[model samples]
Target: MKLLLSFFLIFPLLLSSQSFEKGEKLFVEGKFNQAQLVLENYLKSNPNHLKTLEYLGDIAGQNKAWDKSISYYKKLENLKPTEANYYFKYGGALAMKSLEVNKIKALGMIGEVRSSFEKAIALNPKHIEARWALIELNLQLPAIVGGSESKAIKYSSELRELSPVDGYLSRGHIEEHFNRNTEAEVQYKRAILIGGSKVCYQTLADFYKNKMKQPDKANKVWEEYKNKNNKGIK
Candidate 1:
């Protein structure tokens, strides 16, 4: 009888596991709305399901629902304060929100954004994304707030140690921001050569289109990028 009771007790957990697996598979298959519904329903019964919360946060981010993303990530932050990725995601969402708000509100939110990235790096020193995000944020803000090219350079140095391609990209962003077209082009080209990511290709293409005044070169690069991606389609 006790063994039978144990089986009954375990059955609900088994169902929950199956449900979560199905939801996660749906998410991976790009059925994000369906996955969100399934996961949200699951979270009703399992309120503290950290994985579900994380996915909800990511889904919100994909949908560009910055407020929802912030809520979900903040919950995850409270649940797992030591998690570096949660802070990074939370900061990113907040930064996005800042852009939608007025200047005064954006100023405060920007500070929070920087603080979150700082915490993320403090938790995981080698977090390349967090480091890069911080560098970009510092470069954009004014000197009165947190804008410091020197700080951006420091983070760029650390990123260089972590990833040469990302280091070049950061330097390119710095140069581009300061309107140094020739230097920016050189750094961006080096970044593309070092890393074959879509961001690298797009960055150089944009530089050519806008800064270099070489629309033909930009069109060629963009066409090649589209062709390369289309080849991967099933």
Candidate 2:
């Protein structure tokens, strides 16, 4: 009788461990549908499983099931709201939802995306992607909808401070689009000086040749780019 009780107690544990392992493997392989089914079944048996909730969120996100993903992530957040990655993923899922929906209705989702990203940033100030996304969203949004150049610049500056080397290009983008030619030129040059990029060189060439009508400078930049990339490549 004692032996039977021991086997019964161990059976559920063994089954749960196997199920979790298989579900994780499926999740990693991008088999989200199967993973979701397996995870949902596991959750039925283990309602408060934190890891199960986290993985369910991931699977939902992968499948682009934003509402389901949010539901799972919220459960995880309720359990532990301090986790930065959870907030980031949640915010990212919201952003993806905003993109997937039609444009007219998409703006409605922006508020949720903005709020989620803000919460993520508040929880982890160093989250670069969240900062950049917020900046991009603000820049693209209409002025009537609370977008402002000053806010974009603020976030851009924060991004630069956090990641100086790659941030120069973002500054260039804002300047170029807003018609701040001199500032844009300076930023593009700074980006090239810090770490050479083919795209940066091409951008500078385009700015000089077309926008500024400086063919000599453009030709020089293009030549440098070509020489660096085309050397001994047949």
For residues 13-129, what per-residue lDDT tens digits would candidate 1 score against the true structure?
999888999899999999999999999989999999999999999999999999999999999999999999999999999999999999999998987899899999999998999
Q: What TM-score does candidate 1 get on C-alpha atoms?
A: 0.87
Candidate lDDT values, in order: 0.90, 0.83
- Report the lDDT of model 1 for residue 207: 86
Question: Which consecutive 10 residues in model 1 have the weakest lDDT in total?
Answer: 225-234
Give lDDT for model 1.
Answer: 0.90
CA shift at 73, candidate 2, in angstroms? Answer: 2.3
TM per candidate comes to 0.87, 0.71
The number of the candidate with the highest TM-score is 1
lDDT of 1 at 66: 97
